[model samples]
Target: YVTPVKHEGVELNILPPGEDLEQIVEELWNTGRPGPEFRELLEKSGAYNFYDFIIIDSAPFFDVRYTVLSIYAATRYVVVLRPSIVDSRRTARMLRRLMKYAKDFGLSTPDYMARFLGVINLAKSGTIEADALLNLKFTGVKPSKGFNPFKHPSDERRKNLEKSIEGLRKVINFSNYVLPLNADISRLEFKEIIKGGKSDNDLKNTTENLLKDIWLHATCQK
Candidate 1:
């Protein structure tokens, strides 16, 4: 059930969590069958035609049924990844599961994969970001094919990380999506904007440029 809620004068439809909804979910799971309840609600209301877009954010695990339903409904999917080893490892697991699920549903890998956009968040300087950049470079190149940055005899997650990075690179190129958000100049400019200083123009230009690319990638009809 999506209820309309207003935030800062903007209207947004939100699904409020409650026990009643939980009971329905549990019953749906126990029955092990797809039901018409949600479809009926969506189709009958005709609200789907009213909105320009609907975005679904899922858990790290992808959570099976709900994740499948969301992906089935999505026209485009954007993945937000933190620049770090642990986050890369987690992303590898999540993306592999998502791709497998998509394949099982008879979706073409190229078509399905094309709709994906990747964004690297909170990218900072030093060894951590450098290591992350290296991972991104060999993203789709398999460990068996060539030298892998993550390769280590003791690191059990090396293969998975390699594959995950590859999957991400296949979708989002580093030049487009990797924002230098944590750099000293960027931080100073943003701070000035936040403080209502002279960097207002800087902030506006920066955000507009960033959002232009992001919006184009996310909403552009392929």
Candidate 2:
């Protein structure tokens, strides 16, 4: 039902508008035979065991429905977000609420946070504050939700957390994965991003390390 289109060296599987596959997916979702979400179609696509990963980069026009579908389809997700202290805190709180809502409505399973790999900050290069937020280690914290360590270390427990983080600042450079804002990459399509990033040796090395971390994150999950 789907064909893989080759763009440059990357192969893309697209579901364009008015396609029969799209119509079939819609029919299956409505009839509730296989499932009510797009994720079921993805599982039965015969592509899972063939590829190490399949990224569904789609605009969430249906917001909650699409978000839940993507979350369900993918084993894990990596968030690309800007590094801001307040926004870090807000992101954690918002995700907890989303998980609860998704669970209550049967849209998704619980423990949604477990599938989160990590965040890649889009902050400007040489930004100390952003680096600190990105570099903070995620271990030992009781409630280490996504970006939780980046939130203000206001309380006594959080202060201990900050102390632990400060000790690791020099040792573990997790912020090495941060992809600073670049005009070339901004708003670029998937194929373009892949093509443009191939020439940069520094980017290639860092991306390789990031992929290793992502695989470890997936394998280490319970």
Candidate 3:
């Protein structure tokens, strides 16, 4: 009875109040087994078509059972590994666990483990900025050109954010799949991007770049 919740939407309780699991199971069995009905319900609820790209964000320790089930059902699985010893070790352990689960379930073995895109050295640290991370081959989302937002209120931030966008675009081209979102989608807060009275185009470009990177990184696996 795992609930499928949509991002940026209402959260529905998976297990209803005062529901007895044993009674529900018995009732379902009384109806001559409910596998087909359950499958139809899953499809009819729009959970099947909610998004072209579904990201299952698991906890650091990876104890969630439903997430594991979803990963087995997914066509692609992306594992993000930081360029560090500790993160690499944790990722290896997680992959081992996933393989063990697949074997236990008698699922077919995955092909091409490296096909799952590995984004190395993500995020910035200390005085290092986004551009610095990009220079180190870390895929990021930033403007393309140089524009002093403080000096030019009407100027766009597209120039400044293009490099990261280009890097992400390359990855998307490699993956051969466009995102389900519109080109003008932005996930940033207005306060952060609109400082010094910047144009909306900046936000639009940033959003597009962000979405592209998210999809590319998330679905680049086998």
Taking all chains together, the TM-score of candidate 3 against the true structure is: 0.40
Misplaced by over 4 Å in model 3 are 1-46, 49-55, 60-66, 81-84, 101-115, 119-122, 125-136, 139-187, 190-210, 216-222
**Per-candidate local distance difference test:** 0.55, 0.49, 0.42
* C-alpha TM-scores of all predictions: 0.62, 0.53, 0.40
- What would the per-residue lDDT of candidate 1 be over residues 140-171, giving only the tens digit for each residue? 11123343465542343544554556656765
Give candidate 1 misplaced runs (Cα > 4 Å): 1-10, 30-41, 62-64, 103-106, 130-167, 171-175, 179-206
Q: What's model 2's overall lDDT?
A: 0.49
Could you tell me which residue pairs clash in candidate 1? 139-165, 139-166, 140-166
Clashing pairs in 2: none
lDDT of 3 by residue, 1-222 (tens): 666566547554353324574464356446662434434555677865864644445453544343354454454555554433455556556655555444433555444243344443343332123333333333333422442324332323323333333443333222222121222224544344434244355444443454455565556522
| Tens-digit per-residue lDDT, 1-222, candidate 2 | 356799778777764535474565456557653232455566576667767667665333334444555566666665444455454544454455446534533444434455554444455544444335344532111222333344564445435433543433322223336554555445554344444553455444544555566667656533
Number of backbone collisions per candidate? 3, 0, 9
Better of 1 and 3 by TM-score: 1
> Using alpha carbons, what is the TM-score of model 1?
0.62
Better of 1 and 2 by TM-score: 1
Tell how far residue 73 is off in model 1, in angstroms.
2.5
